[model samples]
Target chain A: MPKYLLIMRGTDESNAAMMAGIDEMIATTRQFIDEMVKAGVLLAAEGLDDPRQGVVVDFSAETPVVTDGPYGETKELFGGFFMLDVASKQEAVEWAKRVPVARGAKIEIRRVPGSDEVPQA
Target chain B: MGTVDVEAVWRIESARIVAALTRFTGDFCLAEDAAQEAVAEALVSWPVTAPVNPGGWLMATARRRAIDAIRRSVALRDRYPLLTADTPPASEPDPDRIDDDLLALMFISCHPVLSPESRVALTLRVVGGLSSEEIARALLVSVPTVQARITRGKKTIAAARIPFELPVADERRERVGGVLTVLYVIFTEGSTATSGDRLVRPGVAYEAIRLARTLAALLPDEPEVHGLLALCELTAARFPARTGPDGSPVLLEDQDRRLWDVSAVRRGLAALARASTRGLGPYGLQAMIAATHAAASSVETTDWERIVVLYEALGRVAPSPVVDLNRAVAVAMATGPERALAIVDELTVSGRLAGSHLVPTVRGELLARLGRRPEARAELELAARLCTNRRERSVLLQKAAGLG
Candidate 1:
């Protein structure tokens, strides 16, 4: 089976809205996770720390340059991701569509190549 | 079965058996050891009493051995209820799920969590059915090192709780790239020794080719897999003419093209066609460059301009200092030495390739073309000193001497 990653992105307004109802959000996400787990498709799921707490290590120069805090542009922030071992990209999309998210949130689905997909001797 | 037949069967089926056992036992290291024990038993008994289905027999034996090990282990006592010594009547693993097991083995062996060297060693051991000593000789590492890498690789996968199953579709693409990179690393080291007396280890290169052909056969739909296979095949075709009979390095321009392997070149071109149909990836682009060289009657007639364009595209997708240096060499052929030298000088100032001999070697050739004999000789001498291969060092020294 191939793997797909569901990248959940949220705008500042949507993130604030979700955080405001944190208890309800956690319950809703847990219920969703439980569904996937019961289906035996979910491999891993993780949510990110606040964007402001992150750092970027730029390697454009001779020495790596480390910068602190949120990225320069903050139109959309990566909120979390789910890795699912599904049969195909379509199936992954179906799973992503069921994710609980507020308005202005987006889930981008990407196919992960499996060992069977890799060429070998 | 004859000894040779037994060896061949073991080589082909070892990975499948180990993978199946791993899935059953939920322990990678134990599964591998059980599989090894089965192969050892096969070597001892197969010649004496050949089985109708060697793969099935091996799988049954391995599965039985796994149960025995689990049953004996104090740590595994809690899982004894889950274990079974019932070797199925059929020798084969469940037909429907065997392919998945093999695929899982590939991913586990080439897991990105392990170091690249560890990946190569472990993959060769578990996937390719090679012994530690064979792997040691192939990669020019000691036997203990090969063993250690394999051991650590298995432990790492187990400790990290890496699943013994194929990844989801989204991660499979990245996983494929990771596996290809491991194969490429092995092939590259085989083709050009990074720090060895000899310029090449033909055995390792051939081993890599074998592994690549297996990959291509199994995953015919993956374009980059074919791309990597094409690259390795075409590059290896030139091996026969790459060195002199006395073991001195033969520069490409001076090597006898007639000695190149025609059959390998044909296979490479066929693989390249497959890659092109799906749109060329980075390895495909590199294979195209090799194809250009292979198709040319001589170095002067090779399409340097096309090579430069491919390199530019390659840079956009997979930018690296080595690619830039290679592009500069192609540029020298397409344009002039002065233009190429400027590019090389820029790379020099960037200091990305400060320790590599390739920079000085290319600079020396460009300087020679520009009639700067003194500077060319000096650069060639420096390259000679930096070179690790005795054969290549001699060739570099010869170039420096000819400048006088």
Candidate 2:
């Protein structure tokens, strides 16, 4: 019953001041992903293409209206995320606390709804 | 052939068998003595028989030795009635019960009555199963120092009559931090020797890391356990790159990206993720900061801003001058040297890092950056004088010379 989605702001700002080459960053990111897979905590995790590719969907209208990507302020934008199944909320929090992010960058922890249902992309 | 090789392997495997025996015998001193006797027998026999199940054989033989010793000792007759009245439990044959013994021995070794140094030595001896000589070599201290620590440690535990069983949940949480602290000190000593020829002692660090991993496995539900594991893993990942070819200290900025342990970093990140399932404690926050560096390919690319933020959080949870000094560095990297220098100067005036060489070294760097060569040289010379490590002193002196 313990499922969690760890959401945080992306690396767009942090990566802006790249004194180190991007190739190294990409490689490190890949290595981090490989580690998550090996540990078996990663149900699904991915870096967004950019906030530009994202969109907001509203169901309040008769038909679903899709807003353009990068809809929110940069500080509030959804960045990267991960989903995991652990033994407890405490376990989930432990995992979230380790994510590489700016100190005050908010990490939103939400229990996945209808976890038994087929996972969506 | 040599006792050192045999002792080294025994040190690695000893805690498990000793812990198991303590549970069966319910006598800490007796169980430990029996284990040592069995090891002595192995030294003589293994060069001949070389059994495959050495640990198992040791546990079985140690139990028998404990039984025999109990029968011979009239002094223990009243105190250890259980041992004198009956044959050793047939249940000792089961290897699975070793877990309980190990848990009990861990608690006893880390009992609250002992000082942190004694706790570390005791845990390494009883729980890690290291001989005094091996531990002495590892710590780079004299054999007598190690012997004194273990003897004093055991006497303290016995005098206090600390229980031979792991505490319940609340008590476990209270003591677990102390236990973890010992392991951390051991690992840190290995990673960066307080005073030694080598920059890193892989053996000590690896032993401590292995112990932390074992504890993490034994207590899978404990968030702090994972936090410790994460911290060790992430720190260990930098081991290969922390030194130059000549064994000189490699500043974090100068370390080669390829030398870092990707696997250890990954393991650390995973552990950090697990730790996050609980509220961010000091260790977890520190691990998170390490993760920022782990995720970066080079120092410049590291998420210094995020690291600074984590340090601020860490300061709240574990307020130490050392943590503050580190945070100052991160703040400087994220913001500017001017800001970081301000903080360091404040710390200096407050006498937070009065005797520490690090504060002066950092101040020198900031002064150098600000184009104050004469002042920077003076600070570097002061740092060199205060620093204990020969290598660090050399670096500070070299920097001072360069400034001049």
Candidate 3:
């Protein structure tokens, strides 16, 4: 079995729509999580807090520049992710397709490679 | 004898204590209540001064509780004396032999009078020594639901006057089968959702294994008993590789075989050997089928011929559509898709599996293998539509799409 991290993200328009109907969205999302839990597939799931409450540190210069509050651009900003152990990338795609996201929002799935997959010295 | 020690004692001896209490009091509910009270007392007192004979201590204390409860009941005054026996702690029956009283307790808990749910709850409660809360969590039901099932089951037993004694000679085998079915149901419930609506509860399956081990020990002469134990062990051995963290099922052929539990496999095979000693019963046949898979490196390497024969025998004894459908799968693997297609077509004509997704799923696969792409796709689409499980439905749709 392989592990997949399903990252949830949305464009500005989609984010605004989610904010407008947060309760219904949350309810559906929770129901989705519950289904996974019942199926015994859910490993971890957590929604990120507002990106505005986050900070960015640019380390390009000798001294890092730290800034707080919202990013200059919210173009499909990362939201939250669910980590799951699934059979294959296809199964992960099915799960991603089932996510209760707004029309413009999309789930990006990345496979977490096994430690054993790496060549040992 | 701290709480840990008390817990250990209770875990190991609670069932026997409850059984003896039931035998003494002739009441299931009362026996359970008294046993719980005794455990509470042990929790309080065992930490200070541990008893030399822990099981006897618990049994004696529980027996006392049952007696006290009866003494307090005015209407039960006349029957009180019969409940109180003069057996000393040193005189407790030999612990090595299988206690008929404990076997009777299992029969009562899994009695045909109770619904399957009630039987599961009662079996875990009295035979496995699980608390109502634990049973609730393990079965994924509310505590109230487990309690209600247990209460209703006990009341029905009392009202029906279901005896505390074991069944007579002729019906004993059937009765034992009932008990095995309860444990099998529990294992399947814990194993996965494929069998029915139940979600996975790892604890429940392990508990069933424990109970089956207990039952196997108690019925050493009965090959089917060992057979069931083997079936549970072997099936559970695959649990490690069966599903993903998010509960997505890993198809057996695609599962990482290296992840399978070896020790469980060893134990299962041993039990299967014992089961074969008396000729394969229904459970033994199933165990043999599981054992075949267990010994295989891959589906390609599996002994499909032996499996087909085993399924044929199983169909004779268990005669279910599911068994026949499974046999068709083996037939395909052992021979070719054409023979397997014939089996599926016969089943479809019979309409024995009208609404199930399984028949069409296999039918579509067979058709696809035979290069009938359009019909295969249609069958797969129908399977997807009929399927209620989101995960399986997704797989079916994916398979259908692949045909394009």
Per-residue lDDT of model 1, residues A1-121, tens digit only: 2568999999999999889988999998997785454333565799999998999898989999999987767767888999975534655765676788988899988776532234333
**How many residue pairs clash in each candidate at the backbone level?**
27, 16, 4
- For model 3, report the TM-score of its A chain: 0.90
lDDT of 3: 0.81
Candidate 2 lDDT tens digits, B1-404: 22223454454457766776676666777877888898888888877776655545676788779878877878665546665455544444443455556667777887879987788888778766677876888888888998888778877877777778878877778878877888899889888888877777766886677677767756677788789889988888888788776788888899886777776788898888899996878888988888898889888889899999899999999998888889889988899889999888889989988988999999999899889999999999999999877777888999999986
Predicted candidate 3 versus true structure: per-residue lDDT over B158-245, tens digit per residue: 8898888888999998899999999998888787655333235556787788788778767788899899989988888888777666
Instruction: Give the distance in Å from residue B5's predicted Cα in candidate 1 to where it truly belongs.
Output: 5.9
Candidate 3 positional error at B197, Å: 9.8
Q: Is the docking of candidate 3 incorrect, acceptable, medium or high quality?
A: incorrect
Off by over 4 Å in 1: A1-121, B1-6, B43-54, B74-96
| lDDT (C-alpha) at residue B218 in model 2 | 63
B1-404 in candidate 1: lDDT tens per residue?
A: 13335555655566767877887788888999998898889878977887866777888888889889988998877766776645442444354476567667878889989988889998888877777877898888899998889888888987898888887999999998988988898898889987677887766776667667666755779999899989998998888788777777787888788878776788799989998897899999999999999999788989899999999999888999999999999999999899999999999899999878889999999999999999999999999898887788888999999999
Write down the DockQ of candidate 1: 0.01
* After superposition, candidate 3 runs with Cα above 4 Å error: A1-121, B5-8, B40-57, B84-91, B96-98, B194-200, B385-390
In the range A1-121, model 3's lDDT, one tens digit per residue, is 3568999988888888999999999999997785454333455799988888989988989999999966668888898999874444655665666689888998888887543244235
